[model samples]
Target: MARRGHHVGVNDTDPPLPAGTPLPPDELGHRLTEVFDLVGPLYRRALRKVEQGEAVEGASVGVRSVLDLLCRKGDLTVPQLSRIQALSRQFVQRMVNDAAAHGWVEVLPNPAHQRSSLIRITEEGRTLIATVLDREHSLNREVGGDLTDAEVRACVRVLREMLRTFDHVDVDD
Candidate 1:
């Protein structure tokens, strides 16, 4: 059996290892594996929620944005909704169609325009968002029970900053 010798004791009195101690890249890879093992399942479970119909807020950001705009702004035409949601006309149309099927939104005649139509949220759609928000908030509270609201906000800010990477920026060696 191979004897392992990397067990550094957790005491401050012990002198630090010499600068020549080589760190195998495999050890760094193992650390990354452990981190992904811990975090990957969280994202997978969230996906599973979508598969199980628990993610009624819609599957894409485009869809959710359209609903949010409709719910917040009352009613709007296709072009109006598309512009407000910053989505392409085609994408907005697709979302509106799916939403219509889910009873989340409906199209009504636009008196202001001869050919265009108005899109508005249905009662069920409003209820669905309220339910989704309540469930999301409850889950957040349950998972982060030990964290204060300020800590949560700070974490969000830090995470957003970390994610604000630019594709145009090049790392030069």
Candidate 2:
């Protein structure tokens, strides 16, 4: 899906849109939605390719990131994870539940707060996450090898700025 479809002569030759004439608010929002719609399948396909020989189940980029965080940071509450991910607490909980069902993580009693429980990664989770990380690193290297470091850094900087303001966007609903 991210295969950078050939626009024939337009790939690198097309001129940038003129002076903010590309997308107005509504159009930008719609294009952003289209980006996600296009990216999800492509992203998943890449992950699938990475896990091709392995028997990894239910591995998505988001799910793998959750596991990676748990692996690196010990345990975290759902809200903590949600905040870190910039996703809804409910959505993160659903992911946690799914991982728990697969024995990749477990919900434990939290002395810090009775209402919030800590989720810890299991040994199985670590093993699977190890494989995921290996493939992820390899994929990143392969994909990023084509781009200059400056290009990658610019991409990261732009996305980070976008993320910082993501929740501030006004919704018409």
Candidate 3:
């Protein structure tokens, strides 16, 4: 039995809208539909490509996220990776395991702690990240080429600020 809030796949049914309502630009419905439109197909295509092994080094987004973190921050222990990524320690460890197995990362002994290991990107990992990053840059340019670099940076800053605000918002009973 699936746990509560653990359902997978799409919900095909649509929700009813208010009668004669002019939907607010930032309404949940508008945002959801926009997310579905942009992310749904991208998710499907990325999944298909991964399944076909077109992108081999970073097979999963979670793994790629970790690699990107390591690329920017250098070596990190599992606990550090978990904290930085806001992921479960087990989850980060799994990515680390996969990365280690594929020669994408190297696990070095942590001098401070005998039981813990620090992971650093290998040369192969850096090479793969360079390729992935180049592709990501091209995709970003295709999507946001109209925006000036400064405008794009400003938009990113604003979006991140919004995210931070939402993170602090408490649920109302």
Candidate 4:
């Protein structure tokens, strides 16, 4: 039996919104704002933990994000990575530059794109990311105790769907 406030795959405070139902702009804004308010702090805290032992050089969240990606996704051109991460090219470029300065990544000439360079992770970066992730497991266990694995998986799926829908919806129109 699920505990109160521990329901899987649905909000506990309210009934589930109907499929294909569009919320009023104000209501949608309010819910999204609430989510950001709650989720943003968690992200910041985790990022801080990941950076704790990192060298002061290139230790900004932006640089860490680039290093994390390069370490996980193998080599990628700047634009390709920017698109995949849903970040602007300029912002990613700056992060990439910082990572390069710290020897966490290497920028090699891209054969297909003369201008965009391929960014690859260095051994040092991999080791550092590994260390961060090793710690993250404990953090995950600490926070995830409130939810069952099924509930967590369902929540992640719903969040991904919401992000996909947001990508298609144009708020201004």
All models: lDDT?
Answer: 0.65, 0.73, 0.69, 0.72
lDDT (C-alpha) at residue 24 in model 1 = 57
Clash pairs, candidate 4, are none
Give the per-residue Cα lDDT of candidate 2 at 62.
Answer: 59
| Model 4 C-alpha lDDT per residue in residues 16-130, reported as the tens digit of each score | 4687677566555556556667778977887777666465343676776777788778899888777767778888889888878878889999898898889999998887667
Give the candidate number with the greatest TM-score: 4
RMSD to true structure for each model, in Å: 10.0, 6.9, 9.8, 6.6
Q: How well does candidate 4 match the true structure in TM-score terms?
A: 0.71
| Superior by TM-score: candidate 2 or candidate 3 | 2
| Candidate 2 ranges with C-alpha deviation above 4 Å | 1-62, 169-173
Higher-lDDT candidate of 1 and 3 = 3
lDDT of 3 at 54: 31
lDDT of 1 by residue, 44-144 (tens): 78646544544455545455667778888899888787665445677788988888888999999989997889998999888876666566567666684
Q: Give the TM-score of candidate 2.
A: 0.63
Better of 2 and 3 by lDDT: 2
How many Å off is the CA of 74 in candidate 2?
A: 2.9
Off by over 4 Å in 1: 1-61, 139-173
User: Could you give candidate 3's per-residue lDDT for residues 75-155 as a string of tens digits?
Assistant: 989988887666778888999898888788999999988888989998888877777767667655667447788876865
lDDT of 2 by residue, 1-173 (tens): 22222223323344545863644565445445555566689768876675563455556555676788999999999988987877778778888987898899999999999999999999999988998877677877766457887887966764575567676643322
Whole-model alpha-carbon lDDT for candidate 3: 0.69
